[model samples]
Target: MNSPDDTHESTVCPGCRAVLPSSRWPETPKYNASPECAEVAGELLGFEVENAARLGYLHQLRIDAYGGQHVSPDAPRIGPVFALNGLYMFLERGSGNLDVRTAHGIMANSYDDWPRLVPPDRVGELTAYDVLIAGGVDEVESALLKWARQVWESWPDDIRETIRELTVELVPERYFRR
Candidate 1:
């Protein structure tokens, strides 16, 4: 049996609490995330941007989902809203063809004010690490979708409903399928 002090040292990310390996990548100043989590996010972003054609809208989905899951005290409230809107559009409305950026623009312009949301104590068990470990474009995409769904479902029902209503009110019917 190993001594208490001899236990493996895994870095626990402040945002997601995912046990990450020793940090090889530098922490990003953009998000209020731990070094390890930010590094993993950076890697994922690099992969998505590098394979933009293959990932398409998923690139934006990953960004929003990650942002939603890792909201900090000082972080802007709109980040999670954007994440849920993206989730509603792609997962709920089946509007994969509708660009996430366009949807965000619509939301931004339609609503001058947004409600302040409280981040849950725990976001989701799946982290960016899970998607990165999938190791291929197809596998990564699958993992990413699963991650997004998990994050979306993790939010409270009321919050989700608010996003649904916002999407319906802000996004015109022409954007959705008949």
Candidate 2:
């Protein structure tokens, strides 16, 4: 068995698969090569995959999303994307645009477009962006759909319009540079 002081090299960070290792725990065989990966693991976000196929998918997605070609591949890190009952939701920001990853695919929206309202049957399809529109992105509601649909739908059309008009995309400055 490898001793606690032994260091092993992993081709990729096991957590976020950020393509490099940052540091390994002192007494563990596991290695973390990227800060983002370390955070995901440190936070106990849980294993994303246990097989090479899924690992490949994760790596490809990271490359496809952010190019992963800068001084740090997948640098700056994506904000937390939450999942409930296996239904995952995340917001992707680009140059002057934002997209929400749904069960279907990534749907792009203008920096200022309103939700257009999900179907009644799809009320559960609340992305964090919906909460961001109704209140603040930093504010996360556990009853996510209730806040997005119940409170938001009850508001007047004018209020929704005002929100859409006033809201701005929260893309980080590094995104523009990429």
Can you list the residue pairs that collide in candidate 2? 21-33, 22-32, 22-33, 22-34
Q: How do the residues 43-151 of candidate 2 rate in per-residue lDDT, one tens digit apiece?
A: 2212223333333223222222221111122322221111110111121222211222221122123232323321122222332223323432223233232432333
lDDT of each: 0.77, 0.27
Angstrom error of the Cα, residue 142, model 1: value is 1.0
TM-score of each: 0.84, 0.18
* Model 1 regions more than 4 Å off: 1-9, 24-30
Residues 1-178, candidate 1: write the lDDT tens digits: 1224544556787767788766555665556577778878878888888878998778767887788788766767777788778877777776664556787888898786777777687777788989888889999999999998888888899999998898888888666642
Worst 10 residues of 2 by lDDT: 80-89
Residue 103 Cα positional deviation in candidate 1, in Å, after optimal superposition: 1.6
Give per-residue lDDT, candidate 1, residue 30. 55
**Candidate no. 2 TM-score:** 0.18
Best by lDDT: 1
Error of 2 at 15 (Å): 15
In Å, residue 160's CA in model 2 sits off its true spot by: 18
